[model samples]
Target: MSDYQPKILSGGEHRSDDEIMADYGVSEDSPLVIMELLQRFHVKDIMRSRNIISLTRENTLREAKELMRDNKISGLPILEGKRLFGMVSMNQIIKALEGGWLDDPCQQHMSTSLVVLEEDIPVSIALKYFHNYTFGRFPVLNKEHEFVGILSQRDITSALLKELTSEISKLEGKTEAAVVEQRPVENVKSEWVIPYYSLRQFVIVRNDLANAGKAANEIKRMLKEAGVNSKIVRKVAVAAYELEINVCIHSLGGSLTIVLDTHKVTIIAKDNGPGIKDVDWACQDGTSTANDWIRSMGFGAGMGLSNCKRVADTFNIKSVVPTGTTVICEFNLSA
Candidate 1:
C-alpha cells in the first residue's frame, strides 16, 4: 500500500459547509442528502471476507514483504488469532529496509494508531475516511471490536457495479413494455381557466454515455419555448437532467416523458429494473448505487432523487426488484 499521509486541518483554513457545497455545485443546505445516500449502504455490504491475508507481530519485515508479494496485496493486517495487533503495509517494509531493520519484528514498525470501520456502519462513513486518509484499506471490526474483515475502495466500487448491472436488467425489461404502450395519442384540453393546451413528448434513453443528457436538455428547451416561468423552467431542467442521467448511468434502456399543461408540468421516468430493492433508501440524497465508471464521469453522487424532490412540487417513485422503476415529478405552474 502507499504511505499513509494525514490531512492537515489548520486554523482559518477550514472550509464551511456552503463552500464545500459550492465546490461540488450542490445546494448549500443539503448536507443531509449525502448522509441519506450513505445510510443504506453498510460496511458489511462491501467488506472482503474475514479470511484475509494477515501477519503476526513476530513476523520479520522480509516475511511481510514476501507475503504481500505472493498475495498481490498492498496491506496486511497484523493479528493475534482473531484480535488485531496493528497494520503493516508495503511502504513500511521499504522504510524498514532503509533503516537497516529488515529483520526486526513487525510490531516494532507497524502502525498501531489505526483508523477502522465498524461492521454495521454506513459505507458513507468509510467513503469519508477514504477521502480523508491515504490508507489503501481499512480494518473492519464487529460489535465486540474483533477484527472481522477488511474494506478497500475497490471492494465498494465492485459492489456498486454489480448493483448497476442488476438495475440495468430491470430497465431493459421495462423498455419492452414501454414500446408496446408508445403510440400516437391526441392531446387533451385542460379544464383550467388559462385555456391551456397540453403538450407531450417522449424520448428514449439508452445506456450511452455519449448522449446521456440530450433528452433533458431538449426538455428544457421545449419548456423555455413554451414561455414557462424562468424559475419553474430551471427546476424542471435540473430534475430532467438528473433523471436522464440516472437512466443513462443505471438503466439498460428507458423512456422519459414530459407532459406540459397550463396548470402543471409532469416528468415521468420509467425503466425496466432489476428494480430498486429499497425505494425509501434510493430516494435519500447521497445514496447512489452507481459504479465507479459513472462516478468517474462526474456523476452518481446519490443526489438524483433528492435534487428532483427538492425542485418538484410533488414527487412519486415506485420500484420493484427484478421488475422496474418509475419516477414521476410534478411541477405546478401556479406554485
Candidate 2:
C-alpha cells in the first residue's frame, strides 16, 4: 500500500499525534504503559467517589444551583428512590434561567433520565467516556442506584497532562493544541441546513452491535422499502450502522432517529452518556478507547466515528452532561 495518507477528520475530536496519545490518558511512549496504569489503579482508587452532590426532582431550582456552586461541580445527579431519575448540570439550570423559569418546579425542569457508570467500573472506561464526549465530569452510580460521585474530566486530564508534561520535560516533549488537517472540499456545498423535521427514533441495542452485519442488512432493506435510491441508501445505511454501533459500544444508549423526505435523509442520534469532550481526537484513525469486550467484537478501532464523517454529507453534534446529547446527520437526496 502507498504510504501516502490524505488528511481526514477523526471522530468529533481533533488532536495532534502527541496530544492524542496523551489525551486518551495513555502513555506517550508505549501501549504497555497504558495497560500497566489501568491494571494498577482500580476504579475505586482512581474514581472520585462519595458525597456526590445530588438534587431530587422535588428540589427547587435555587437549590440545584446552590449545590453545584457549593460543590464546585458542573453537574448533579437527580435521584428518586433507588433509581437514577435524571441529571441537572449548570447548563440545564442555565437553560431554565435563560428561559425565565427560575420558579419552575425542579421536578419539571431537571433532567428525568441520565447516563451513569457503576462504582466498581474501570477508571479507563470513565477516561474513555471523557475522551469521547470531552466532558468536564460524569456522574457515578452504585448498583443500588445510589449516587456515588462524579468523575471529572479535569481530574483525568490533569493527571494525564501532568504525566505527559513530566515525561516531556525530561525528554523531547511539548504541548500542542492538535490540528484537524484536511484538504478543503471544492466545487461542492460543504454546508447545508435541515429546514426542520422529525423522525422515528430507535435505540441501538447491544445485541445489534454484536451482529452489525445482520443489522446493516436489515437497515439496507428498510431504506429500500422506504424508496430511497440505491446510492443514497448505501451511504445512509453504512453511516447509520457505524454510528449505531458506536453508541452501543461507546456511549451508554443513544437513539437513531430517521428523518426521511423525498429529497433527503436526516438521522439524529441523541445520547445520555458524557458529551464528546474532545471533538478533534475522536476523528483520528487507529485511535480508540474500546475495551477488550468491544475489541473482541472486532470493532471500536477508532474507525467508527471517522467512517460516519466520510459517509454522511453533513453531521452535527450537541451534548451536555446531566442534559444528554444529540447528533444530527443529513444525507442529500436526488430529485
Q: Which candidate leads the pack in lDDT?
A: 1
Clash pairs (backbone) in predicted model 1: 33-285, 37-286, 37-287, 170-272, 170-273, 170-274, 171-272, 171-273, 174-272
Residue 288, model 1: lDDT of 94
lDDT of 1 by residue, 1-335 (tens): 33332222212224554454354444424333233334556999878887898988899888999898888988898887777878898789889879989899998899887887778877655666665567788888877778899999888778766765764675576557655644434545432123455544444545455557776887788788778998999999899889888876676457788878778999998876668888899889899988654675688899999999999999999987777888999999998
RMSD of each: 10.1, 24.4
In candidate 1, stretches whose alpha carbon ends up further than 4 angstroms from where it belongs are 1-38, 181-335
Model 2 ranges with Cα > 4 A deviation: 1-198, 206-208, 211-216
What is the alpha-carbon lDDT for the whole of candidate 1?
0.74
- Give the whole-model CA lDDT for all candidates, comma-separated: 0.74, 0.60
Worst 10 residues of 2 by lDDT: 174-183
Question: Model 1 compared with the native: what TM-score?
Answer: 0.49
Clashes of each: 9, 20
